[model samples]
Target: MKTIEIQIEDYITNDKDLISVIKRVIKDKKKILLQAPMGTGKSSLILDYLSKEFNILMAIPNTAQIETIEKRNGIFCLYGDKQQKGYRSETTVVSTPDRLLQATECFKTKNIDCLIVDESHELYTTANYRPKFKNIMTLQSTLKNTSILHMSATPQANLTCLKGFYDIFIKIDSKKKLKTSIDIYDMELNPSNIKNIINKYKTNNNNTFIYFDDKSMNEELAEELNLINVNADNKKNNEILSEIKAKNKINENIIFTSVIRAGIDILNEKNAVLIICAKSNLTTDDTIQLIGRFRNNLSKTVIIKNFKNEDTEKNNQSYEQILNQKKKYLKSINDDIKRWEENKIKYTKEDCTEIKKKLTELIEIFIELNEKGEKIEENHRYKINTHRVEISAYSQLQKNKTKNIDNMIKLLEKTEAIKIENIEKKDLNKKANKSFNKKIQEKSTEKRELKNKELKQRIEYLSNNLSTLQLELFMEGSTLKTLEMTLEKGQREDRELRDALRKTLSVVEPKSKYYKTIQQIKKYITNDIRDAFKYITQRELSTCKKDIIQEQIIRNNISWIKDKNVEIATDIIKNKIIFIRHFKILQILDNYGLIKNSSRISKKILKKIEDILIKEKYFDGIKKKNYQKIIMQDLELIFNLSRNNKEIRISSIKTKNMNIENKKQTA
Candidate 1:
C-alpha cells in the first residue's frame, strides 16, 4: 500500500490534486482509506462534492448522524426498522451500517458504485466486542465487489485486510490547531467532585458539557445539578443540540454520555467540556472525538480526570496471544463436537438431551470465538504484537507518557494539551464538604417548606369538605329527631282526642238533639285525629330514608378525606395510614347498601375502587397485592371470614329496616 499525506488547508483552498489522486485510485479500481481530523469537512467532501461526481452510498455510525447528514445535505437516508423504499435508486444514499446489513438483498439487486464507511473505526473498536461483529463481517463480504472508502479522524483497522482491496491510504493533516486547553484533574469523579466542578464553571457564566459514560449516573447528576441530560434514549437530543448551536441561553450546563461523541457538531465558542474519566471505557480516540464535537476554533476550556487504570495496563495481552487462545478454544470445541457425533448412538434419551444442551452452549461460544478471530485477523493482523485494537485512554496515556499522544494531543506544554496540577485532597474535601452541606441545608429548607405547604393545602381541602359533610349529617340527624318527637306528640294527641270522642259517642248517641250533636262532634274529632296521624307517619318515613342516604354520603366523604391525606403523609407513615384507611373504607363498603348483601367484598368491587382511586391520581407506586391484602384482611375481621384454599367463608349479616308503620300504629 502507498501512503500519502496532504495538508488540509491546501485541500480546502485547492483540492484539485487530492481529487486527482482519488480519480486515479478509482480508475485503478482500488479502495480508498481517508484519514482526517474531525471538523475538517470529511462528510462535506463526500456528500457535497464526491456525490455530485460518483454514485455513493455512505454508511454512518448511527441513526442520529444519518438524520443529521440527510437534513444538512438533502440526501436520501435510510435507517431504523422502517427504511425508505427505492433508496437504491438514489445516486447518493446515507444509512447506518446495521441498516445496510439488513438490506443486503436490496443492495445485491442494485449496484453501489462506492461505499463510504464513515466513522469506520467503530467496526473494530465497538462491533468487534459485540455479537454484531458477525453481521459487520457479513456486510463486508457482501459488499466486497463495491469500491470501499473508509474515513475517520482516529482510524484503526486491519491493514492486512485492506491491503488487498484498498491500495491508497490518504491522511489529511490540518494546519489550523484547536484553541482548547485541557485541564487534567488527578482525582476521582463522585457526585461531590462533579458538583464542585460544575459550580466553579457556573460561577464564570460559561456553558458546560459534562461527559460521563454511565447513563443512570449522568441522569442523577443532571438532576442534582438541574441540567439537561442527553443520551441515546433521550429523544430531545436533536432539539437540545439545535438550541446549543443556535446559542439559546438555556441551562448553563448539560450532561451527556457517548451518544454525542461523534458525527454531531456543536459550534459554540463559549462552550467548555468536562469529562469524568474514572472507571470509564472510553478510549483516547473516543475522548478526542468527544472534544472534537465542539467545532469552533475559539479558546475554550476542557477538564478531564487524570485517572490511570493500573489493572488494564498490567493485564494487557498481545493480539496474537489472544487470537491463539481463541483459536485453541475453537479447536477444542470442534473436537468435542466431533466426539459427541461419533458416540451419540450409545447415549440414552436423557443423556442425549443433556448432551444436546451442552452442545448448544458450546456451539454458541464457538460461533462467537470464530467471528472474533476473523475480525482480529482482518483488523489487527498487522498489530499482532500490540495490545487490543481499542486501548483505554489510561493505558494509552501511560504507555505514551506525556510527550506525544499519537500526534493527536501532542502533549505540548506551550499548547496546554495536558495541564497537570497537584490538587490538594484536604482543600477539595473542605470545598466539597462546604458545598455539600450548603446544598443539603438548602434542600432541607426547600423540602420542609414544600411539605408544609402541601400539608396545609391538604388540611384545608379535607377540613372544608369534611365540615360541610358533617354539618349536613348533623342537620339531617337533628331534623329526623325533631320529626320523630313531633310525630309522637301528634300521635298522643290524636289518641287522646279519639278516646274522648269514643266515650262521648258511647254516653250520648241514644238520646235526643243533644246526643245527636255530641255524636256529630265526636265523629268530626275522630276524622281530624286520623288525618293528622297519617300525615305524621308519612313524614317520619320520608325523614328516615333521607337520614340513611345522608349517612352514606358522610361515609363516602370521610373515606375520600382519608385518601387525600395519604398523599401528604411521610414515607415512613404512608403505608401504615394507607392500610388503616383502606381497611376501614373496605369494611364499611362491604356492609354498605351500595353493594348487594354479601359478607365478603368481591374482587370486582375492590377493582372498581382501585380504578376510581387510580383515576383520581391516588395509590401511585403502591403494589396491587398489598392493596388487595389490606382489603381482604379488613373483610375477614369485619365478617368473621375464614379462607380454606381459595374459598372464603364469610358470616352473613342481615340488614335492618326501620319499622316506622308499627311505631305509628302503636302510638
Candidate 2:
C-alpha cells in the first residue's frame, strides 16, 4: 500500500471536526457519514483536501449547477454533458446520480479510493435511487480501500437503518451565524395572489427567487413578471443562469425561475430575499437548504403558502344546495330500508352469506387496485408529475357499491318468501304519472317523423343515380357491343377441355377461394389501369390458342412471353407465361410509354381503355363512377370497390367498415 500526505494549508478554519474526520477516515479506510448545513463551505473543504492525491467523483443532485458547483468547489472536474464524452480519462467526474448511472459501464475505477454522495438523503427516495443505486454501488467492487462518504444535513431514515453503512458520524459547524425569517400566508392559489405577493415582497427588484411546485403554473408566473425582460425567448434554465451571472446585483431583470431549492447553491444571492412555496411540516434541513443561498446573517426567507382544499365544490352551487341534495338521497335510502324491515322479507342463511361473500370479494378487489394506485402516485412533493387517470378509486368504489345493491335486490325478488310488492308499487307509481305518458307519446311521434323523412330522402337520391348504373338481368338479350360481337357467339363453347395452369407463383393466399379452377387465385396488380385496358385485337384473336370465359361471358385472352429479360432466344422461347382475359401485347405497349421512348403510340385509344379498367375497380375511386363500368347507356355499375359487389351507385350509402387483410379490402 502507498501512503501520501494530505495538504490544505489555511484553506479551512474553525471546522476542526471536518478536517479531523477526513484524515482519520482516509488513514483507516472506513465508511464515514458527514452532516454539514448549507453555506458552511463543506464541499469546498473536502474537494481541496482530496484533489491533491485522490480522484474525487462528487454526485451532484442539481444537474443545472454542474459548472457552478465545480468552479465553487475549486476543482477542475469533468461532468456528464454532450461535449464531455471522453469522461473515462477524467480523474475527477462530477455529475448527478442519474447521469452517473447511465455512464457507469465506462468507469474503470478498480476499487475507488473515495466516493462522495451529495444530497445523501436521496439515497432512499425510491424514484431517485432505485436505478442509480444499482450503478453507484458498483464502486464498491472497484474500490481499493477507504469508505463511501455520504454527506447531507439531514440523512433519510432508510439509509440510516442499513447496518455497517457508516462507521463514524461527523457534524461540521459553520462559523457564520444562521439568520432566517419565514412568513406563512393562506392566500388563494391564483394569478391575482401571485401578483400581490410579487408586488408586496419583491424588494430590490429581481434579487428574489420564486419557485412553484406545479410546472404547468410556472409559465403563468413567468408571464406575471414579463416586464423584467425575464419572459425572453431563452429556455427556463438558460434564462435563469444568465440572470444570475449578470453584473448588476439583481435589479430590474424580470427573471422567473422555478429553481433555487434543493442542492442548488447561488454565491451571488447573499443579502437577497428568498420567496418560497412551502408546505406544512417543514424540516430544519429543508429550510436551511432553501435559505442557504446567502451566507450573510442579513439574508432572510419568506414562505408564502396556501392551504389546499381537496374537497372544494366542483360546480357553481351554494353549500346549502349540496347539503339538500345529500339529505334527500339519504332520506330516500332510509325509507327503503325501513320498508324492507317492515315487510319482513325472509331469506336462507346460506344465500345471504353467499351474497355477503361476493360483495366482500368485490370490495377487496377494488382495495387491491387502490393500493397499487397509491404506490404509483408516490413522488417527490416538490417535483410532482401531471397525469390524467380517468377513473378514480372513489368512483369505482361507488360503482361497485351500486352493483352490490342491485344484485342484492334481484336476489331478494327471486326468493319466494321476500315479497317486494311495496318497493315495486312505489317505483311503478312514479312511471304511471300523466305527464310521463304525455312525454313518451311526443317522443314516439318525433322519432316516427324523423324516420319517415330519412326514407323519403333516400328514395329520391337512388332515383337520381339510377340511369348512371345500368344492370342486365339476362345477358343473352344484352345489346352491349363486347357481349354481342364476341366470336364465341355462334359456336358451342367446349365445356371440358384440359385447362392446365402451366406455371405457378404464390405470393399471398386468399382467405376464400373465388375460383375452383385456380383453387386460390389471388392476383396482385401493380401496373396502371390503362396498361391492362387493351382488349384482344381482331387480328391477334385469329392466331390465339384458347379463350377463358367467365360467367358464360367471353373475357379477353392473349399469349405472353414468360420472361422479358432473356439474353438468349432459347430462354425466351422456353419461358412463356400466358395470361387470360388480359392482352400482354397491349400491356407491353402501355408499359413501354412509361420509358419515354415511344412517340408513335395512340394515346387517345389508350386513355379510353384506361377509363374502362377504372370502372372495374382497378384503381382508386372518386365522387364519380368509373365511366368504363358504364356502357353508352347500359352500364352495370357496382359502386363498391370489391369485385362482384352488390352495392349499386343509385342510392346514398355508407360503408360501415372497410377491413384490409394483406391489401385485400373486405367491407
Candidate 3:
C-alpha cells in the first residue's frame, strides 16, 4: 500500500489531539474516532489528508451540505438514466445509506481506495449504522486494506458498536480553549423584551441564527418577528445551508430554526445569543450540541437562559442521586483541565477562559446548595446540574405532607364496604347519563349528510370525465375518423376468425388443442404490453414477432359466423380502440404540459396508456372487453340524449328534496 503523510496544522487551528489519533489510526491501518463539537473544522481536517486517488465516502445528515461537499471534492453524481462513471480522481459525499452503498460498489468495481465517514455518530445507532456496516462489509477485503476514519462530535453510548473497526479514539475538547469566552445570563422577559434584544444584536451583525425547541414555538416566534418587519424563515435540514447563503447575499440578519441539535457551520459572526425557555428540561447532550455551534467561530457566546426552579418534593431522592453524578462528572472535567494547565500543555487562550467559566458555574451550584438548607462539606468538590438542584429542594419541603397523605389513605380503607357501595352506585348512574348524552350528541345527521355529499361529488367527477371523453369521440373530424375507419375494416377481416374462437370455447372438449392455443396467446399478450409501445413502424413488426404471432393466433382461431367470429372482430377492434384511447390521453397530457420531448410524443402516449392498463384494474377490464360492447356503452351512458336527461332530472329532484328538508328543519 502507498501513502502520503500530510500536516494537519494547515487545516485545523490547535488540533493536536485530532492529529495524534489520525496519525496512529493511519499507521496501523485501523479505523479512528474523531469527536468534536459543531462548527469545528472536522471536514477540512480530513479533506487535507485526501489525495487525488483517495476513495472517500463522506456522509452528512443534510443533502444540501452533502452536495456542497460533493462539489468541493469535484465529484459528479449520476441523475436519472445517467451511468455511474467517475470523471477523474474525485471524492463522493452522499446523503443516504442506499446511495452510499451503491457508490461503494462502484468504487470497488473501479479499484478506488480509502473510506471516510462524516457525522459518524449517526452510524453507531442500529437503524442506519447497522445496514451501512453490512453494505461496506461486502467490500470488506478492499475497505479493510485501505484507511478508514470516522468523525463526529458525539460517540454512541456503546463504543463497541464502532469498535470493530475503530481501535483509536481522539477527542477535541472545546472546553480546553482559553479565549472561548462564555457568559451565562438569567433573563426573565416577555415576548416584547425578547424581540428587542434580538433586534439589537441582529442590527449589529447580519450572521445570526435563533434556534427554538420545536416547530410550533418556532412558528409562533417567527410570526412575532415578521410583524416587526424582520425577515425570518423556518429551517429545514435540506434547505438551511442554501437559505443561509441567500440571506448572507442580501445581508439578512436572522435565521429562525428548531434545529437546535444538528451540527451547522456558520462563518464570520462576531457575537451570538441563545434564548432558552424556562419551563423546559433540555438534556445535557442537547445543551452541549447547541453551545457547540458557537465554538469554532471567533465570537463571544452569551446564553440567555430562563432557569425555572423545580419542585423536588416528589422526586427528591432521584434528583439528589443525579445531582451527585453531575458534580462528580464536572469535578473530573475541571481536574483534567487543571492537570493540563499545570503541566504547561499546548493550551490556547480559549482553553483558559473555558476553565474559568466552569469554575464560576461550580461556585454557583455551591451557593444554591447552601440556600437549599443542605450542609456543604469543606474542601469537597461541590457540583450540580440545574435539574437536580430543583428536584432535591422540592423533595425536602413535601416530606411531612407525604406521610400525612399515607395516614389518610389508611383511614379511608377502613370504612364499611356497604356504605361505600351506595355512594359508588349513585356516582356510576350520574356518569352513565353523562356518557350517553355525549354519544347521542356526536351522532349528528348534518355530519353524515356532509360526508355523503363529498362522496357523491367524487362519483360525479369520474362520471363527468367519462362523458367528456364520449363527446370528444363523437365530435372528432381528423384523428378519430382515421382510427374508426381502420378499426372497422380490421373488425370485418376478424369477423370469421372470432366466430371460430367462441365455437372452440363453447365446444371445449377436455383435450382440445384450439383451447390451449387461445390460452397461450392470451398469456403472450399479457407479457407483450411491455414492449408493444416500442413498435414505431410496420417495418418494426418483425422485431415484435411475439406480439405479431399472438395477434395472428387470436384472429385465426374464430370458427363460427356469430359467436366466435364476433370475439375475433372484438379483439381486433379493442386493440385499435386502445390505441385511440392512448392517443387522446397523450393529447390531454401534452396540452397540460405534462409530456416533454414532443417528437416522440406518440410513443410516450402509448407507453403511458399501457402503464395505466397495467396499474388500474378497472381500465384493464375495460380494455379487455368486446369493442362493440364498449362503443355501445360509451354511446348510451355518455353520448345519448335520453341518458343525460335522466341524470340531470335525478340530480335536480334530489337537490329539491334536500332544500325542502332544510326548510322543514329550520322551521
Candidate 4:
C-alpha cells in the first residue's frame, strides 16, 4: 500500500544469489528455469533483479504483481492491472489482450532489455482465445538483445526435451519438499459422526475453519454450520476470518474448503485441518501449494476424516504407479552415477540440485503412503460409515489398452466377434476362407521405377508449360499497366479542369443580370427593386457551351425574351436581344412575381405562355391529361405577362466611351 521509489541500480546489492544466477545465464545466453515454492519469495527475488538489473518488460497474470512495480516507481516497464488502476510514469499496465498487443507493437519499434514472465506455466495451456502468451513469444523472436526470464512454481517436465533449449539451467530445492504434520480424528460419538466432531469444537466457541474437496460440498457444509448456534452468537465476516486464522494456528476445529490451495498464506493461524475423502487425489503441485499456507514452520494438525465406508483402492494404486515411475527414473540416474568415472561424465552442483528435486518427489510419495497406512493391491474393499465399497486396481490399468484392444471389446459387444453361440457351419467356412485368402493372396503394389518415371515426366512437362505461360502473362500485365496509367492520367486532368470552371461560375454574376440592368434603366421604375427581380435572372452556363447567348437563357431557363417590338440595346450590347413576349416556361415557379432579381428557377408558364412554350416542344411527348394541372399553370404565367398588361421588360446598362474621331472633326 505504501509508495516505493526503486531504481534498477538498487537491485545490484539485493538478493545477490538470485541476481548472480540470472546474470550468469543471461550473459551466456542460456535458457534457465527457476523452480521454487510459492512462498519462498520466487516472484519478488527475480522481479527485484529484473527491476534493478535491466529495463524490465514483465508479463504477470494479474494486478498484484503490477502494483508492486508501480508503487516502486520501476522504470519503463509493462505490467497488468485488473482493477482499472492507472499507469505510473514508467509503468504501463496492459490489462487486456488488445492493450498488450498494442504495447508489443511499440516494443517492436524499440529494444526491451529483458522479458520477465511470471506464472510461466500459463504458456503451455494457452488456447487460441488466449493469445497473450503467443504474442509474447512473437515479440521475443523480434527482440535480439532481449533475454527471457520465465519464473514458475510448476514447469513442464518435457520443456527441457525440446530443441534450442538443450543446455538449460534447472535450479530446484530437492531437500525442501514441503513437510506438514497431518492428523486423523475419529469422532466415535452418535449416529451422525461428523456432527459430533463439530459439536465438540463449537463448545469452545472460537473460530473454526473447515475445508471441503469440492464447491458443492463446501456450500453444503456452510449451510449446515449456519443452522448451528452457540450462545446466541452468529458467524459474521470478522468472526469467520479470525476463526480460520485461529484454527490454522492452533491446528484445531475449522470448516473445510478448497480455498486453502494456491498462493494464499495462513502463517498466523494457530492450527489447521485437511480432510481427505476417498475421492480426493491431490497432485504433488497442489499439495505443495496447499501446505505452503502453514507458514509458521511450527507443528500443525491436518485432520483427515477417513469415512469408514469409502473405497480408496483405485487412488492408492494410481499413487503407487506414479511413485514407482519416479523411483525407476532415479534408480537409473543413481546407477549412472556409480559408473560415471568409466563413462567420463561429470555434473555440477546445479545438476545435482535438479536431479535431487526429481528424486525427492518420488521419495515423498512413498512417505505419504506409509503415513496414511494405504495398502496397494490388485483389488480392495473398504467400509465407510456402514456400507462396503469395492475399489478395483484393474480399473486404472484398463486405461493403458491399445486402440485395437478397445475395438475388439466393442466388436464382441456388437456380436461381430464371431460368437460361438451364434456360429453355424456356413459362417465358419466363410471366415476360414476369408482368412486363407488374406494370408496367401499376394498383395501387390505399384513398381517404384515405373511410378517415378511417370511422375518425373509429368512434372517436367508441366514445369515447361507453366514457365512459358508465366513469361507471357508477365509481359502482358506490364503492357496493360502502362496503358491503364496513361488513361487514368488523362481522365484525372479533364475532371480537374471542369471542377475549376464550375468553381469560377459559382462566384460569377448571372448573364441575365446584364440584360436585366439595361431593361431596368429603360422601364422608368422609381422604387427600389423588389424580390420579383430574381425571376428575370438566368442560370449560368457550363464551361463546355458552344453558344454563350442561347445557353444563357434556354440551357436551364424557365422563361425567355419574346416581344419583337422591344428595341435591342445594340450600340452598348449589339448581340443582346430585347423582346416583350409571353415568356414561356418548361418548369413552373410557385409565384413568378416573388422571384428574386439574381436567381434561376424553372417553371411552365400560364396558358398563353404554354402556347409559346409548346412552340419549342416545352411539353413534348408529355400527355396533356397527365400533367394538365402544371400545364394550366404554365399557360397562366404567359397570359399575365402577355402584351396587354403586367409585362416587366429588362435591359443591360453600360459605361460611356470617347473616340479619337471627335478630335479630328474639331481640327
The global Cα lDDT (0 to 1) of model 4 is 0.36
Q: Write the per-residue lDDT of candidate 4 for residues 445-511, one digit (tens) a residue.
A: 1233444454344333322332343323322222333323443344346544333323222212323
Best by lDDT: 1
Clash pairs, candidate 2, are 110-142, 111-142, 111-143, 111-144, 112-142, 112-143, 228-254, 556-581, 562-577
Candidate 4 residues lying further than 4 Å off, grouped into runs, are 1-18, 62-110, 122-143, 156-166, 172-179, 183-209, 226-262, 274-281, 301-667
Candidate 4, run of 10 with poorest lDDT: 382-391
Better of 1 and 4 by TM-score: 1
C-alpha RMSD values across all candidates: 28.8, 30.2, 30.2, 40.7
| Ranking of predictions according to lDDT | 1, 3, 2, 4
TM-score of candidate 1 versus the correct structure, residues matched by position: 0.52
| Model 1, position 59: C-alpha lDDT score | 79
Most TM-score-accurate candidate: 1
lDDT of 1 by residue, 228-278 (tens): 788876746457866744545444467877766646667654554454443
Per-candidate clash tally: 1, 9, 30, 60
Report lDDT per candidate. 0.50, 0.39, 0.39, 0.36
Give the deviation of candidate 2 from the true structure as CA RMSD: 30.2
Higher TM-score: candidate 1 or 3?
1
